[model samples]
Target: RGLFPSFFREAQRREVLLEDLLYVSSAFERIAEATEEMLAEMEDSLRKPVDPEEFRHFWLALAEDLEREL
Candidate 1:
């Protein structure tokens, strides 16, 4: 599924060009790539044992991040 088919549909109805959509989509593409890289790094770190306190801190920080907007 696409991220925002309805949004693109509306934009098209409003006469937005395909080039404009492609231009804006680059930002989403970059964000997705960066997120994948960060998650990969986190996964590599977690492959080994971690300190209990540090793990707790990481979870708390992630929760705080999720509580806010991107």
Candidate 2:
């Protein structure tokens, strides 16, 4: 299976250029929202401030998820 799933089939007609890009953009937004939620959960569990190293892991995961979703 493709890592980034196509949102539409080839048989479907495109009425306007860049219309499909909107769908992909929305999917990316969802991916970002999920990442933010996961990070928030981690933040909630921590008594001390989140360290730079820990934040880097969270950011890398977000980027990876966005790449896959896109």
Q: Evaluated with TM-score, which candidate comes out highest?
A: 1
What are the clash counts of all predictions, listed in order?
0, 0
- lDDT tens per residue, model 2, 1-70: 5533443543244534467888889999999999999999888877577699979999999999999999
After superposing candidate 1, which stretches have Cα over 4 Å from the reference? 1-16, 51-70
**Residue 57 of model 1, lDDT score:** 98
Task: Record all residue pairs in model 1 with backbone atoms less than 3 Å apart, i.e. clashing.
Answer: none
Candidate 1's displacement at residue 25, Å, is 1.5
Residue lDDT tens for model 1, 1-70: 5859988888877675666788789988999999999999999987978799998999999999998856
Model 1 residue 29 distance off true place after TM-score fit, in angstroms: 1.1
TM-score of each: 0.43, 0.42
